[model samples]
Target: MAANPWFSWTYVVENADTLWEHTVQHAVLTVEAVAIATVIAVPLGILVSRIRWLAGIVIGTAAVLYTVPSLALFAILAPLLGIGRTPVLIGLVAYALLVILRNTVAGLDAVDPAVLDAARGLGYGPGRVLVHVSLPNALPSVVAGLRLATVSTVAMVTVGVVVGYGGLGQLMFQGFRNNFYRAEIMAATLACVLLAVVLDVAIWAGGRALTPWRERRRA
Candidate 1:
């Protein structure tokens, strides 16, 4: 039987097992990284917002981390993490800080000063103002950060294959290695892209659900 071209469904279907495995691995690692990034970044963001001068330093440092090539980052960390999900998760969390940190800063800064003043006028302390006033106002931007982080995390998981993490990139690389050539490569690439898109849409919907105030403004 003649082998189909890369674009053909039959050609891709043949590699379905490998492709599915990689997809699952990629999704799992992404979720883990995003969860950790949110936990770390949100609190750091809040702290930085109060510090004025320090916000620039902290955010600039995170932005520098974002610019590092994922492959290179993984390569450097691979020795320490020793070829597994650990290196991949570390790199993903680093990448996420740029988006999450920026959005958090922007969201917190966007809160109405008048509203904050009113909260303080009502005898609310710094803690109450932050919890009830600032956080709710910033939820939209925080959600935006999550959306960006999720998509970036999904795309970057391909680099995990370098560390033997076996994400979808593993299927793509495997196909290339075995001379299965076109079909497996195309299928794996398409699957990764589809996974990112689905994650993006899901996060966006969740954001809308969680921040109805933003929706009301649009309406």
Candidate 2:
């Protein structure tokens, strides 16, 4: 009876449905949180670039939020939100905001002042300059930030188990609580690693595709 405590086909075979559900939930949580963060952060980043004074305040707030414990966030939100995925979603988004925001700011700031002047000389207004020049130049940095935030969020989703909506985290945590069931824990852990790798790769490829000129310049 070649039994491995860490993993077993029997466990996977029996829990296939549950595992699939958990994996989907994990992906959903990651996508929703990151997508929401990107939508909020990018525009805010653009605004901040234009309004220098707002940069410190907004980034500082997001930084503070990022430092808060996930469990504490769940606890704080549980009363008003009631429970489950909502709190988790908010927490993940908060966690992701700083990374994306910082990257956006950095990307924009890194753009050449000469380029902005050139756009202005060409009779481009601020909006047109931003849309045509600054953003495209800064896109690679923004893409890198997205990749980092995404990978971080994938790992952070496990913390949502406290609110009963952690996706693969639920399974991973449960296995430990249930007398350290190795196979269950291993499966969930591996699934999370796989999810993170897949998302990171996809984002990287997409970024590369979008920023092909960057490659040409480097070469």
Best by lDDT: 2
Q: lDDT of all the models against the reference? A: 0.87, 0.92
TM-score per candidate, chains pooled: 0.92, 0.95
- Cα lDDT tens digits for candidate 1, 39-110: 989998898889888888999899999999988999999988798888888999999988998899899999
Estimate candidate 1's alpha-carbon lDDT, on a 0 to 1 scale. Answer: 0.87
Candidate 2: lDDT over CA atoms? 0.92
lDDT of 2 by residue, 84-170 (tens): 999999999999999999999899999999999999999999889999999999998899899999999999999888878899999
